[model samples]
Target chain A: MKYHGGHFICAVWKLDIRLWQLLIMASLLLAGVWFRDFSLYPAQIAFTFAAGLITQAIFLRLFKLEQHGFLSATITCFGLCLLLRSSALWVHPAVASLVMASKFLIRPQGAHLFNPANLGVVLGLSFFPETWVTSGQWGQDLTTALWLIAAGFFIARNAKRLDITAYFLLFYASLFLVIRVAWYGYTLPVFFHQFQNGALLLFAFFMISDPMTIPRHHKARILHAAVVAVLAYIWQYQLYWNQGIIWGLFWATFLVPLWNHLFPAPRYQWQALSGEHT
Target chain B: MTTRLIFLLLALSISQTSQAFCGFYVAKADASLYNQASQVVMTRKDDKTVLSLMNDYQGELKDFALVVPVPQVLTEGQIHIGDAKLFKHIDDFSAPRLVEYHDEDPCQPPVMYEKMMSAPMPTAAMPQKAKSDKSLGVTVEAEYTVGEYDIVILSAKESDGLEKWLQASGYKIPKGASAALKPYIKQNLKFFVAKVNLKEQNKTGLKFLRPLQFAFESPKFMLPIRLGMINAKGPQDLLVYILTEKGRVESSNYQTLKLPSNMDIPVYIKDNFADFYKALFETQVKKQNLRAVFTEYFWNMGWCDPCASEPLSYEELKQLGVFWLNQNSNAPQVMSGGGVPVQVTRLHVRYTPDSFPEDLSFQETRDTENFQGRYVLRHAWQGKPEQCEAAKTYFEQLAKRHEQEAKTLAELTGWELSDIKKKMNLNDAPDQESTDQWWKKIW
Candidate 1:
């Protein structure tokens, strides 16, 4: 029954990673709103969090789920705030509520089927005409890019999800390089310009690399990254669709169940592994 | 005196009283505020786009030529000569506006001010064959004489061959144009080469070039700015007026930022609004390192809150390539009886070759939020001491407000604070008697 020093340290480490993610997300939102002049209103952000947390509480109560906490909801709220834009006040909260509800409702084999933020954005865009994401809102600036990459490395390292992030960036960047530089004969700066987008970096590190929603096995994860990258490239370059990354990830989500079935691995638990990389 | 040919489009004023509580429009800061600014009006609905290109090319008529990259070879029917007046209407409607509001009487109900200050306006070629050999790898896909333009649509097999073909035909293209043309050629985009047809020009009897418009259906909603930048002197200004059915159109690759708007500056700006906007824009471009596309105005064509110019009429909107307007006669209206809802997003970009390497690509967002680069000038209440306490207190607050406005102008234009204060005639320095009293006490 005695608690050991290692046990105390492990408990602290588990909370530390979530704290880091929260801090990074909050700072990025602040930078975006303050310096980048994001078209998000204060009331929209407040309502989004209220709707996300309230819906999460309601779903927890109705489902009689025991593991009820604010950490996951907080992460989802930040993600929504970072990506979703709406002139109307209702869209953010409405989308946030649906996203939080999906975590409980859309359960497949006791795991959330889709990333909560990603689902919310895709659905919001499809259903509401007023809601859209501005991918170019975060233009490629050297200072901001370095800042995001540095912070993203810390979060990815702590989460042990760097494999997916690395693979996703590699695949996406190589395609851009080929199209902009080699085939088109554009200068190297054009290639760098496309790759340095902050939205792409944010997507690579934060949204698509969500641990719980991704495939459980490493091989499945790599495949998932490659497929999403290819689809995103085609969507943006070939089909000329906006929000290609979001669309790619949304379509790629259905493959998770198949991937997990083929290559089974232990289910990821936030508490079981500390900030230590596996 | 050398004869200066100035073609003026008669300004048609459509006066309609606005019901919205937004301030009344006093003056406009149009693309004319910038020198060498090229105006392009692009109306897109889904995959269909109609682009109207107008430039102030004041050189010899024979030397005037424009070569643009088209997604497909445009037929003669796709090309039309647009009325220069339509550009004026859209520009007058969506140009960054200066609106005035009179400060109410401190002792009585408010009265809005009506005085306005007006500002001064700021005020491609071809290929040859020759090496007309079929083996030169250049194919002229289509050729036509539309309006006063001799148009040739070319699809090239290689950049070198295309450059050689252009040179052989006496199109005087810039030296580095081949490198710029390679990417568009690789993308299979046809080159739209146009030069003035002297015979047609003489028949038109107009000194200025009429805007050239082309309607095309392609999945790509982009403007090829790279080809234009090849021989650019220093920096070029492009005023892109985009009209979409749903919402705002924004640059996909570059940051699309709404210019600083809805700020109250000094009333003196009403007289010098042109100079103020020019300096303000220059400062913003420098601050962003000249790497941003600035949205000067985005509003529904149905109505304007402050009627900068009257909302373009249904006929005018149709002329600007709003093909969806006829189909959706019942499109959602922002204002009752204000015409069909067509969103106009006026984007102004000042780009150097270094700042912008790629052609500007755009996407129409579903955000229907209305925004405009509107600056306000509030005329202070001129009440006497015979009035009530409110009047007395208003003067005290007015001084502070004036100081704040001066600071804002300085910060926005990168002007010296001292110089702005001097210009503002901020003479509220500590009284000589008060200073002497303090000195007397010390002595």
Candidate 2:
């Protein structure tokens, strides 16, 4: 198979990629239905599906996410779904849909100005005074942490950003240790829960590993990821303000281009010396 | 370089060691009581003496004496000795001597010694009685010193009391003798022992012609006796009964009394004196009774103002019908919106235009008018003509009641109706004509 833009389907029309992405998204939807034990009423199911699809379509179109291709659309949709699920605590489904729709207004370009998930959570919390609720469980519950970790590892490997991932983990661990010592005198159970919970695992693998947003050089990428992880860990566990991962990812994306310009690695040179005609 | 490093280390160690014991110190003295004409001797640990002589008493200590340990200097104003701070002036001294001391010296601390010395003296001899009789009490004489004054207490028997006392005595008790005798009697009386300023008087001898009976009286019995003396001139021979149990003067029935030459009688017993007595008596009675009162009322009538309305009942609240609904049921939900019932748990009401007998009615009308006006304005701005028309009908009835209440309040308070109109800022009365005109313009 021939490749365009490092993807086998990149040469295909943009609409075809979108259609393929939608099929994958539908399969995810079916998985949710199959996994959930409580049978949703047909009307409820229809409403839920329609709300998700309309919100996803409206925000994507408004933000011009199509220009970024199927990958961007898929990542944005996945992030939006996870955020909406989390925000279901305080707001009605329709209101959550409306909140998700507001992403287009806040987005600067085809990509989000802030992390869409973090912005959605903050906007929902502030705008709807009566019904701002939090989804207490991340993924499904504590049990899903292992699956998330495995998925993160798989994603990191495929992105060929192992050094960057390792650096991120190391930097995060150090920051966590420092803050834990300062706050609780040692690393606490709550600190581990904070690391496992929310968009942290997903963000490390998906957002930080974005090839277009991060630096291309291995060393630069390592530094970039490490900085992001440290900042994110500080914001979440140390500062105790929500949406640290989003801010970390946003800042790390900006820093990648700057790091590439400032710290370029020396070019490889091999010396060829001829023995004097022996 | 190594020598310099060693020197630096030595310097650091010296500084650190010296820093521990360095603290501020204060020296204090009371100059007023201290005789500046005499020399001051200060003893030190080395048995060496620092002397401040009479000539060293300049108005400011800084002018004459040297402040030792040059960096630490003495302040010139008033100095504190122990807890007491004495001024520089000589006459202000009440103590016999002044002591000087430093606060920081842990060993051989401060010391004080008396500046003046005196010996205790014996009492003066008492005069022997000339005669003794059974009717009067035993004759005795005593003398005591009070500061510089001498006082004597003398008692004579009845046989030597009247005529012999007149002959033997150089001074005769005044003719209507009760006046002169009153103070002497009061002094000797046992009832006055606790209350009088006997201990304060600097006296040596008390001479009594007769031993006055000392009977203790309660405060209740004494109060009236005190009041009688306060009212009357000179001293009256009054028959006073004292309440034995409660310490009060029961009565003072005054007879004819002679006036002293210097005394102003009427001005001394003014109306204020009577008022003071009456006030004291009334306060006592009120305290005995322990009477006080408090009352509160709560009521709910039909209609009221928005801000000052009674709480709505649960059934009444159900009419709004908004509920909190959780949208994402799958996630651990923290909040929700939709039809969640809210029940009114408390009620409070406040009324104004208080003088108007129909204050509740008046407030209701005013509140209704204001509410309707706001509603109409909002609907009109929203382009909801139907709602605005409905609100207009509600406003018409409100305007009538407001006018009636305004007229009633004006008449009751004797205020001009025009003043009421001005205060309300009404362009014209809220009659049918104005209402029709207002509607036409708005529509």
Candidate 3:
């Protein structure tokens, strides 16, 4: 039991959950490009990764922050590749750099202000004429939707932020049910159709539940999730706009500082994710 | 070689027979490919939208029924009957094209390239009805006779009352339609009901009903298509021509996929391009499981590379409900890139009731990149395979290319590989006895 070789193996076994996150995100992107016919080109995706990682390197060096790592930035790169679409080549790298820079530059307190990829997409959709989000890029196919939900659940749990995802989805689904089915008289399938969306699930588990951005207090996080849900609903149904969830998260970001101030909780550390040793 | 003029025949889905260039251009695949296909042209800018709906109703004129839920009650000036030729032109312009380019002589450098386009298909549909009465919770907002048709606009408080009013007015209402109409009614949408008036129809002396168009202002950028699925027997084909100011229009809810395009196919497909296209589309829809909308074409109004049909003129564009075109006399030459900036997006969907649970919603993006469903055919030079070293090498590569083309055709259409090989006549090539054969060197 005291063998040095055994100790080495155990250390390797306790690899960071961020590596698992990178793996899951990479697989989802690959599956979308190959089977789902995502319009993302390989060169564009490479540019995204290059821009994200390079920016992360620059920021880490600028602050000389040895504790920060490339894993989170790389994850944001995958998020950008999965959500953002553009005919022009430059939009991807530009968006990735802006969002990665946000991680370091946009800190409100000790935590980053917005989920990098979510804010990147919102800014791209707002500012860039060539860029757009293919919210329906992943069709409402059962296999893809199930894979997203299952993968999202895994990561949300490992990151200790499953509460936000669960609450956000619950609140959003109930809103759809009440307005679309009960009030508007749409059938149940119409309501369920929205659930099968890959974009919505991706936002719930990945964007809204971003542990670094959401409220640190448990109760505050739940309230944050519901606020995002209602804002997203209003953006989509009332305004008849696209990228509702993305904008929803972007607008909800302003309240995070207030939530953290009111409901104080201990600061989060990457090592906390190792509690379950996933 | 410098002066040789090798005529390239472009079916343009253009020439049904005569591959004549510098002459007449006809569309290849018209909307007659399907049984019950309905075509709609929607041109919108800001809050103003003009929608034109085309129906090929072969049934008894009295039984032809169309009830569309609209955002506002359309006035008489808002309604107009349009020429069917406009639909034909737009369909031809956006149809998936089969372009054929002949290879230059192996001994000489290449020069010429030609391209052309084709048609639209049909789908299944049922009927809808409505009326206006205070007691029945239906208000007759307006009535009009735009062309050879009687039109009525009715605002209703409930779906059942609207259905009853239509039924009593002798309109054919499909069963369970009230359920489908409920959502639109609750959304406060008024109904635009139209039926053919046989007496006025005889005066026009046209065999088919002209397309119906209406212009209105609304924030909703959507097509009320779910109501048409009330009594749908099976999946139906819908061709939507969306003209916008800045960029392309895509479904906000459903996946907007582009058909696999721009590949080389066997020259034999030239004879049966229509059937080839049908197979290509059917196979793609099967792959998507009828769950996605396909973008057949998206291009600016300025020009076409190899025009499938002559670009729609400004007058014709206006007739097709492009309200944004300026009244300047110079705008008539929109083909010169000087007219009002309009981009057309042709979206095709083979939709079933189960796959499409809700009405389609759309959004316009600021992307002007042009795309089309383009297929290519490469014809070999007529030079002798033994004419020169280049000729022999060309012949060798040609045989291999044909083999690959056969495989591609099978993959695209989900056809039998063996059958494609048989059709390609891959057995009797002269390359079999070429001097480069390894057996000759051994001897």
Candidate 4:
């Protein structure tokens, strides 16, 4: 194959990536409108579109992420959607927007910073005690569980962090068992409901799978994901009634950079012997 | 550094432990009109010292409970009344309860101190033989009930022999030997109980004895009289006077009368004296409009010299008389500056340490000089100015009287009259001029 001109490559790349970005945005808006509630459709749709474009622009500038990185952008957009929804549920819209804006200004390092949704909601709740964020609309039923598992698995596959995903699932399940035994008195249905509750499935898939912020090494990423899963499970089941996924995402993001620094990525050199078809 | 840290930790632990038990209560007592009944109860608790009052009545009650950790005996642990006291033991913890009355509105309950006013008088005869041999001297006995406790006061001459007796009898003479005796007597005094005569031997069940209620008179309304002692020892030179409203003898509405001589004494008071006095006065005023009459007796006679003597030169005495005349005389003379006719019944000079002795003597001499020189100088300087010009003419006549008397006394005492006149002439001459002229000079 002959090498293509730089402009031709750039135009094609932009067109393809923009199409994928638009698809991801539409899916997020539809999910917010349909699954969340018809009442919240307008606000959720508007906030998701604005937040997605703004966050993508911010991450592109801060991390120099390539235009073709549709998987990374889509994952981030989903995370932002969940954050806006959670913030709106837990705190006043104005306050949640203010908190989200604060995260952008304070730590602009994309997913490497504190998980925007979790930090914002926790801080908003702490600051405004009279407000409460709840997921009362999402019924704790089996249908919700299947929907979360499917979505989580799909996102996990797209991000190509299968080992990290598996580790998180095992860690969360084990933690749930321990918490159930210690505090709630063992019940299978309670455990299932706890796992399926509010944006947990969405967080597990989109938030936890941010490749740029997650460790590249398989073992390190698995361990980081496991820690995040355990923390999330404890916060949700043991602590009870909290933004557990937000905390989980924050811990995972925090640990990834530390793990990367400690265990540097393996370097691959170009092999001249490949010219001879060896 | 480690020692300091350990010490800090130790101090913190000690403070926390102490704070756990140190507490107090705010108590309120109410009594109804007609003195029919009363009720006393605490409102809130601080640590362990439950603030309570003593009253003789029956009613409903309300109070708050505060639990803490430190032992209640520490000095920092105080029940704040006007004068707070520390809780000596846990049993001292019971605060006064509201009295229960069946059918009457409760009156304001008597405060802890006022309860003393209602105590019955002690009988003239001694109830029991003196526990000590030296206790036979004059004893002043007083009894009063405060809250649920009875208080008595007994004053007897101090005797070493009594100390020995109490010691030999295994009685612990409490610390603060002299002060503790009053409470001891109050606690031990027994009341007489009447029994049914046993002439009818066939009385099946025991008949009851007549109940005896102690009779106590309310204290007279009195202001706190503070006597200041100047150059005397042992309260000898001190005289105290308490002035009060005419009809209310027991009411606290009276003021302390400050006599000219009282200014001589040095004033010293206990730390919470003001609070005690205020609480006392408030309680007395609530009962009735009150006043007090106080008289002082010197423990020693030597300090009475200044109080008894009258010292003034003849000319000085005349001037003193004239000064009083000036002060007592009405304005706008009755007869064209001829001096308004007035009777002088008494003229005397009063002195105390607070009074400047020098100023008194100077005033006396100035009045004696007849003010002749003053009038002459004023006339020469301004030719009869308005305002006080008529008074000046009257002062001139009084000065003439003083001059004659000063000379007479001077000759009789063999003193130089010139020296007396010279002193009298030293009074400051008045300056009278138009405001315009005065401003002209200033500018």
DockQ scores of the candidates? 0.47, 0.00, 0.38, 0.00
lDDT of 4 by residue, B1-443 (tens): 42453244233211111111111112211111113211111111111112222222122111111111111121211222211111111011211111111111112233332221100000111122223233444232333332222222333343233333333433334333332232213223211111112332124232221111122111111111111112212211111111111110111111111111111000111222233223332333222222211111111111111111112222221221212223433341233322222211111111232221111100000000000000000111222223355545645544454455445434333446565455445224222223337576786
lDDT of 1 at B429: 48
Q: In what order do the candidates fall by lDDT, top score first?
A: 1, 3, 4, 2
- Estimate, for each residue in A1-278, the C-alpha lDDT of model 4 and write its tens digit: 23367776544433432234335545654664575442233544444444444544554567565542434334344444444432132223334344344544654323335544455555554564323333322433346557666755654554456567677778887776765533333335445545655355555654565444567688788788778877777665444325566666665566666776677775211111111110
- Model 3 lDDT per residue over A210-238, tens place: 78888999999999989999999999988
The lowest-lDDT stretch of 10 consecutive residues in candidate 2 chain B is B359-368
Note the B-chain TM-score for every model.
Answer: 0.87, 0.17, 0.86, 0.18
Cα lDDT tens digits for candidate 2, A1-278? 23355543443322332243344435434544454211222333343344545566666677676643333434444444444332122232344355445545543323234444444445554564322222212322344456556755654554455566667767886676665544323324434535554245555654555444456577787778777886787665445344566666655655654666677643222111111110
- Report per-candidate TM-score of chain A alone: 0.92, 0.56, 0.94, 0.65
DockQ of structure 4: 0.00
Stretches > 4 Å off in candidate 3: A1-13, A276-278, B1-27, B109-131, B332-340, B429-443
Segments in model 1 whose C-alpha atoms lie over 4 Å from true places: A1-16, A271-278, B1-24, B109-132, B327-339, B429-443
Q: Write the per-residue lDDT of candidate 3 for residues B103-212, one digit (tens) a residue.
A: 77888765554433321111222234434467779898998887987888888888888877777777667787788888888989998888777789899999999999
Q: How close is candidate 2 at the interface, in terms of C-alpha RMSD after superposing the true interface residues?
A: 41.4
Candidate 2 residue-wise lDDT at B213: 19
**Residue range B1-443, candidate 1, lDDT tens digits:** 10110011012111233235446687888877877889999999889999999968888887787888899999999999999999988999888889887788889866554534221001134333323357778888888999998889988989988888887887887888898889888989898888888899999999999999999998988988888887788888999999988788889999999988888898888888989999999999999999999999887787676777777766777878887665444443444554355789999999998889788999888877678888899988777845898888888778778878887899888988888777777766433335558566776
Alpha carbon lDDT of each predicted model = 0.82, 0.32, 0.81, 0.33
Better of 3 and 4 by TM-score: 3
